[model samples]
Target: MALSWDDEPTTAAPAAAAGNPEASAADVAKRVNADDKRIINAKTDVNQLVPFKYKWAWDKYLAGCANHWMPQEVNMQRDIELWKNPNGLTED
Candidate 1:
């Protein structure tokens, strides 16, 4: 199926606004230390070491949202272009 760049996904609330700060911090700590969260396979280890593959997939899924589609630096450039011209369509 063809993709539609005009349909951008909405960004969720910031972490601070999503929940209580203290609770969110505690949850983050818990997840970081949880043994069950440790890698169980080489695939997981590789993914952690090289995240670009996953990032590319995510970017493709969130196409029109340039913030998510590109890296931080590239996003900044794209943001400026997008601001000047709001249409999300890309040549790709």
Candidate 2:
């Protein structure tokens, strides 16, 4: 696939958005990974942006989002108790 930075975007790129507080655009029209299905030269947040090359990671992210969990909301008392219990578990 051929991508030219000179070519306009159908939708505004994140780097071009004034509303975006933080933006990183690659100076060259090349990607950090050319093989990945990403914009030709768009500078994107690796964590925020999903890459076609790493679809499994994206799937895991989606699965995690669906659960709608917060670290504070999780109860670790059971785990602590289990760790303290000598009979239930032992250190290898």
Q: Estimate each model's TM-score.
A: 0.21, 0.25
Residue 4 displacement in candidate 2 (angstroms):
16
> Model 1: how far is 34 from its true place, Å?
7.6
Q: Per-residue lDDT of 1-92 in model 1, one digit per residue for the tens?
A: 22345666667445655658886776667534333344543234332533456877767656645545435444487667776885765676
Off by over 4 Å in 1: 1-31, 46-92
Model 1 poorest ten-residue lDDT run:
41-50
Q: Which stretches of candidate 2 lie over 4 Å from their true place?
A: 1-64, 90-92
lDDT of candidate 2 over 1-92, digit per residue (tens): 55786867676344645564344333334455533645666566444555546889889878888889777788989988988988869666
Best model number under TM-score: 2
Candidate 1 lDDT score at position 6: 66
Q: Look at candidate 1 and tell me the lDDT of residue 3.
A: 32
